[model samples]
Target: MTTQHRTIAFIGAGNMTQSIVGGMVASGYPADAIFVSNPSPGKLEKIAAELGVHTSQDNAEVANKADVIVLAVKPQLMADVCAALREQVAHLADKLIVTIAAGIRISKYRQYLGDDIRMIRVMPNTPSLVGKGMSGLVADDRVDDSDKSFITTAFDGVGATLWVSDEDELDILGAVAGSGPAYFFEFMASLQKAAVALGFDRDKARQMVQQTALGAAEMAIHSELELEDLRKQVTSKGGSTAKGIEQYQAYDIDKISADAVKAAVKRNQEMAELF
Candidate 1:
C-alpha cells in the first residue's frame, strides 16, 4: 500500500515524531492523513501548525483513527500511556504498533497492549531530526511482511535502517548508533577546543572540524576500501596525521571507545530492568 493510504498516528508529538512527520510530508505523504497526539497542547499546536497534520490530546483518539500507532513516549511514562490505551487496543489486530521508546521491551508492551499486537520496536537516534538517522528495527513474529515493508519505508524517509533478528541487538545498536551521535559530538568538541588552544578562533575551528568530518564520512560511505586502508591513505610515514595516529594508539583510544560502548550497553540493560 502507498503512504497516502496509511494513516499513521504518533502517540507523542515530540521532536523525533515531528521529524518523521516532516520527512514523510516532504516525501509526498499526505499530511492530512497523519495524526499526532501529545499531552501538552502546545506541542500539538506547533506540530499541527507546522506539518498540517491532525493533532489530539487523547492518545486513544489518535490510535483509534489510524492504521499505524507510534508509541513515542518516554520509557518511564510508557506503562502509564499503554495502560490508558489498553482498552482501545482490543480491536487493533489489523493495526501496526510501533514503539520508539528506548529500553522498554516487547514483552512489557504485550503485558499491557496484549500479546497479539502487531508490534515493532525501533531504536532511532536524534540525528533523525535532521533526516540523517540510523534506525535499528525488530518486530514481533506476528507482524507480516507487508507491515514490515511499510514501516521500513516510513523510516527510510529519515535515513538508513537495519532489521535485526532479536530485540537484544536493538540494545546493542542503541549503544552504537542510538547514542553514537553524542560520541561524535564529543569528539568534534574536543577537536574544536584543541584547535582553539592552538590559536584558531572558535567559529573557524568548528567550521574546519565540521566540514572535515562531513567529508570523511561521505568518503567512507562512497569508498570501497576498508576504513583502515582509508586511514593509511591519509597518514604518511612520518607526517602530522601519522603523529596524530601514534598519539591515539599510545592513549589506547580504541579500548576506551570499546569500554564506553560496553558501559552504554550495560546501562541500557539496567534501564530495561528498571523501566
Candidate 2:
C-alpha cells in the first residue's frame, strides 16, 4: 500500500478534521483522494469548497470507499457513530481505522467495531490547524507495518508524530501534548495581565507576550541545550530575570505544573469510564 494512493475518509467534518485535512492538502496530499462526511451540510460545504475533497452525509458510504477511515467525532458520540457503521463492518473489515477521540480505549473500539479490527488511536492538539501540531499515536498489534507507515505519513503532514509503546501512555501524552496548548495560553494570558498592570495597552501587551512565547518555543526546538540551561542563559546572577525566576520557584511552579498534568490525566481516565 502506497500511502499517496490510499483513499482516506474523515467520518466527521469538525474543526480537527478540517485542520488535519487542510494541513494534509497544504502538505500536498491529494485532495481528490480524501473523503469527508457529516450529518450537517454546513461544515461539509465549507470544507469541500475550501479543500476540494469528496463530501457525503452518509457515514457508511464514505467508509465503504475509504482505505483509511479517520473517526474524528467527539468522544460522547463515538458509540453511536460506531453503531451506525456496524452494518458496513463486512465492507470495512480490511481497512484501517484511525480514531482521534480522547479517553476511549482501543478495547472499547474493538467492542464497537469488531474483535479483530485493526485500529490506531491518536491524540492530536489544536496547533494542527497551523501545521505545527503534536500527535501521539498507539496502534493495535494486528495492524501491519504498511498501514502504520501510511498513518504516520498522513499525520506528519500536520505535525510531528510520536508512537507510544502502550495505550495507557497515550492518556499521559494526552495530558501533556493534548492539553498542553491551553497551559501555555494561560501563562501568556497571565503575562499579558501583568503587562497591562504595568501600563502597557492590552493589544501591545498581548503582542509582546505572544511573540516572546513563539520565540522561546522556536529557540527550544533549535537549541541543543536543556530547558533549564536555556533559562539560566537568560538569567544573570541577581538580575531582573533571576528575580522573576526566584518568584516562579518560590511559587512552586514545578509542583503546579505536575498537579495540572495529573488533573488532566485523571479527567481522561474518568472520560474513559464514561465512554
Candidate 3:
C-alpha cells in the first residue's frame, strides 16, 4: 500500500492494463503514481478517467516517467514499439520492464534493449479483473533483487504469482491457466442449459452448476487426494456419478480435454517462434 517509491507505467491502455492499474490503486499506491498511454486519444481518456493516472499518446513520455514499465500491448506490436522508443529508453537503464504480453519471450526483449536493462515477462489472465488471476513470472539475468521485490508487489495486487525456473512450462500454462477459464465457463453454461431443459428454473439451475464447479475446485485444492482418487471416491458402482464418469470415459473425454490443451499450447509455441 505504501507506494511512495512507485512510478509505474503501462504502454497500452486497454482492459487488462486498467485492471492492473486498479489493483495498484486499491493496494494503496497513489492514483497519481500510475501512468498509462495509448496511440488513441479515446483509449487514453477512458483509462485515465477510470484510474486518475497520467495518460498520453506517447510511449516515450510514459517510459521516461516510470520506474517500472509495463508493456501490455498485443505481441505483434512489441518489436515496432521497442524500435520506436529504443533511443528514448536509455534512461530506463535503472528501471525494470515487466511485460504481460503472451508469447513474447524475455529473450526477445533482450534483443531490443541494451545489456544494462532488466526485463521480465509475465503471463497474466483476464480473471485479474476480479482480483483472482494467476501470473507466472520469469526474469532475465540483468534483474536485481530490488527489482524482483518491486515486481512481486506489482503482480501480487492482481492475484497469486508463481515464479518458474524455466518459462517453457508457462507456454503450456498460458493454455491451461490463461485460456482455460473460458473452456470451463462454456462447460458450465452447457450444464446449466441442460438443467433448464430438464425443467429446472434458470436461476436455480445456474446456482447448481456454480456450486458444483466451486465444490469440485475446492476438493482439488484442499484435499491431498489426486483428482482421479477424488473422482473414484464419488463414483460408486451404478450411481449417477459413476454413470456420468462411464459416459465420459466411453466417449474418450480425457483425450478430448487433452487435445484441447495441446492445441492451445502448440499455437502459443508457434506464436513465440514467430516473435
Candidate 4:
C-alpha cells in the first residue's frame, strides 16, 4: 500500500466526511485521487456517484490504496477501525492520519496504533458543510513540518484553521468556535420570529435577521479592534443600543455565555478521559 500523496480516503461516507471530501474536490483535488469507503456498499456507491471518486465497502482496500487515511468514523467505532488497520497504519511510515472526532487525543491514536505514529487531530464544526467553518489543528510530536503544512492547506479549503500546540486548548476552541455557529443561528431564528411578531412578512423577517447576523460577523472578521471595542462602537452614550446593552448586562448574558463555554469544555475533557 502507498501513503504518498493527498489521495485521501475517508473511512466514513457521512455528511461531515462528505463536507471535507466536497471541500477537497472543490479545492482542486482530482476525483481520481480521492477515495471513500464504508461498510455499506450502497452508501459507498452513493458517495462515489456524487464525488466521482473511487469507492469501496472494504475498509482494508481503502487502507491499501489511500495515502492520507482519515479516521472519520464515529468515536464508538474508532477503536475497532484503528485495531482493524493497526498494521496498515504502522505500514504508513510516511502517511499521516488526520482525525476530526472531538475529544479524542493523539495518545488515543498511539494507543490504537503505536506510540511513535504520525498523526494530526483536527476539530472542525458542522458549518464546514458550507465552507464557512473554523478548525483547530494539533500535530503529534512525530509529525514534521511538511505534515503540519499539508494539514493546514487541506483544512483551509473549508474556512479557517488555527494551529495549536496544547491539545487541551483544543477543547476550549471546540466548545466555542466549533459549536458556536449553532448558537448564533438559533439567535437569528429567534430574532426572525421577533420581527415577524412585529408584523413583518416571514421572508422580510428572515432577511432582516439573516443579513444583520451576517453583517455583524463580517464586521468582526474585518475589524482590527477587539470584541469589546466592536461592541462599544455600536453603543452610544444614553442611546437605544446602550439601553439594550444595559438590559443584557442586567440579565448577566455575558456570564451566561462564559459559563456555557466552560461547561462545554469541561464536558469534553470528561468525555476524553472516559473515551
Candidate 5:
C-alpha cells in the first residue's frame, strides 16, 4: 500500500510517538490517517486537539484499524501489552508491526505476538522530539519491500532512517545514535560548567555552549570534509585550538569515548537478557 494511504496507529502516546506524529503532520502526512492510544487520556487528548488525529484508550480498537501498528510502549511494559492483545493476534496477522522499544529482541516479540507476524524493530533517540533524530531499523525476513518502503517513509518524517542487515547491528547503533544525544549533552554541559568557572554567568555560559554546538553541527552537516579534516581546519599548528585538542588527547578522550559507547552497547545487551 502507498504510505500516504496507510492508516498508522501508535499504540502508546508517549514523547517519541508524539514526536513522530508531529513530524508526520508537519511533513503533510494526513493526520486523519493517524491514530494514537494511551491508557491515560491526557496525552491522547492533547495530540488529537493539536494534530487533528484520532485518539482512543483501547489498544485493540486502535490496532484493528491500522495498516501499521507502532509498539511504542516502554520495554518493560511490552510483554504485558502484547499479552493483553493476544486475543487480537489473529486479526493482526497481515498488519505491519513496528516497535520502538529498546532491548527486547524480535524473538521475544514472536513469542508474544506470533512467529508469522511481519515485524520491524526500530531504535530512535530523544532527538526525534525535534525532528533531528536518527533511527536504525531491522525487520523480520517475512517483511516485504513494500512494507520496508512504507516504514522508511513513515520514519523519514522525523529524521533519517538506516536499515541494517542484522539486529545486532541495530543494538550497536542504539549505543551510538540512540545514546549519542546524551553523550553530546554531557560534553556540552561540561563546557558550560567550564565557561561558568571562567567567570561567565550561568545563562551566558549555556547560551555560548549551545550556540557553539549548533554551529559546529551545522558546519559538519554542510561540509564535505571528513571530521578529522574539519578539526584540523580549526586547529592551526600550535594554536589555542591545537592546545585544547592537545588537552583532550592528553586526557585520552578517544579512549573515553570508545569506552562509553562500549558501556552503552553492553547495557543494551544486558537489557535484552533482562527483558
Candidate 6:
C-alpha cells in the first residue's frame, strides 16, 4: 500500500514516537492520517499540537482506525499493552504491527498477539530524534514484501534503514546501533571534562566536541574512503594525532569498546529472557 493512503497509528507518544511522527510530517506524510495514543493526555496533546496528528487515550481506538499500528511502548509495558489490544488486534487482519521496543522477539509478539498477526521488530537508535536514525528491521514470515516495503518507507523519513532476514541480527543491532549513541556520549563527556580541566570554559568545550563529532560523522557518511582509511588520512606518522592514537592504544580502547558493546548485548539478551 502507498504511504499516503496508509493510516498509521503509534501506540505510544514517547520521544522516539514523536521523532518518527515529526520526521513523517517533515517528509510530507499526511498529518491527519497519523494517529498517536498515550494514557496520559499531556504527551498526546503535545504531539497532536506539534505534529497535527490525531490523538487518543484508548489503544483499541487507534488499532481500530489504523491500517498500520506501531508498538512504541516501553519493553516492560509491552505485554500488558498487547493484552489490552489482543481482542481488537485479533479482528484486524489487514493491519500491520511494527515494534521499536528492543529485545522483544517476533515469536514473543506472536505469542502475545497471535500466530497469524503480521509483526516487525525494529532496533532504532536515539539519533532518530534528530532525523538521523539507523534502524535494523526484521519482519515475521506473515509480513509480505508490500508490508515490509511500506514499513521501510515510513521509517526512511527518520533516517537510514536495513532489512535483516535474520532475527538474531536485530537483537545484535540493539547493542551496536541502538546503544551506540551512549558510547559516543560517554566519549564526548570525557572530552568535555578534559577540556574543562585544561582551563577551557564548559560551554566552549562542549561546542568544540559537539562540532567535531558532527563534522566527523558527516565526513564518514559522505567520504568514499573506509573509516580506518579516513583515520589514517588524518594521522601522519609521528604527528600529534598519532600521539593521541598511541595513548588510545595504550589504554586498550579497542578492547574496552568491544567489552562495553558485549555487555550491552548481554543486557539485551537478558531483557529478552525477562520479557
Deviation from native of the Cα of residue 39 in model 5, angstroms: 0.9
lDDT by residue for model 6 (179-218), tens: 8998899999999999999999999999999999999999
Q: Could you tell me how far off, in angstroms, the CA of residue 150 lies in candidate 1 after the best superposition?
A: 0.8
Residue by residue across 1-275, what tens digits does model 1's lDDT show? 56446998999888899888888888888898899999989999898888899999989999998999999988888989988888764477678899999999899888878777879999998889899999999998998888898888889889999999998888899999998999999999999999999999999999999999999999999999999999999999999999999998999998989998999999999899986
Report the C-alpha lDDT of model 4 over 1-275, residue by residue, as the tens digit. 32224677788888788888888778777888888888878877777888898988877788777677888889988998988888554366566788998888888878887775689999998878889889999887888887787778778888899998778889999989887987788778888887888899999899888888889989999999998999999999999989978977998988888998999899999989876
Query: Model 6 — TM-score against the truth?
Result: 0.94
31-65: candidate 5 lDDT, tens digit per residue: 98999999999999999999999999999888888
lDDT of each: 0.90, 0.91, 0.84, 0.83, 0.91, 0.88
- The TM-scores, one per candidate, come to 0.96, 0.96, 0.87, 0.91, 0.97, 0.94
Q: In terms of lDDT, which candidate is stronger, 1 or 2?
A: 2
- Shift in Å, residue 67, candidate 2: 1.2
Cα miss at 33, model 5 (Å)? Answer: 1.5
Q: In candidate 1, which residue ranges exceed 4 Å CA deviation? A: 1-4
Tell me how far candidate 5 lies from the true structure as C-alpha RMSD in angstroms: 1.2
**Candidate 5 weakest ten by summed lDDT:** 84-93
Question: Model 1, poorest ten-residue lDDT window?
Answer: 86-95
| Deviation from native of the Cα of residue 264 in model 3, angstroms | 1.8
Error of 6 at 24 (Å): 1.1
Poorly placed runs, candidate 3 (over 4 Å): 1-4, 196-204, 222-225
Off by over 4 Å in 2: none
Question: For candidate 3, what is the total of clashing residue pairs?
Answer: 0
255 Cα displacement, candidate 6 (Å): 1.3
lDDT of 2: 0.91
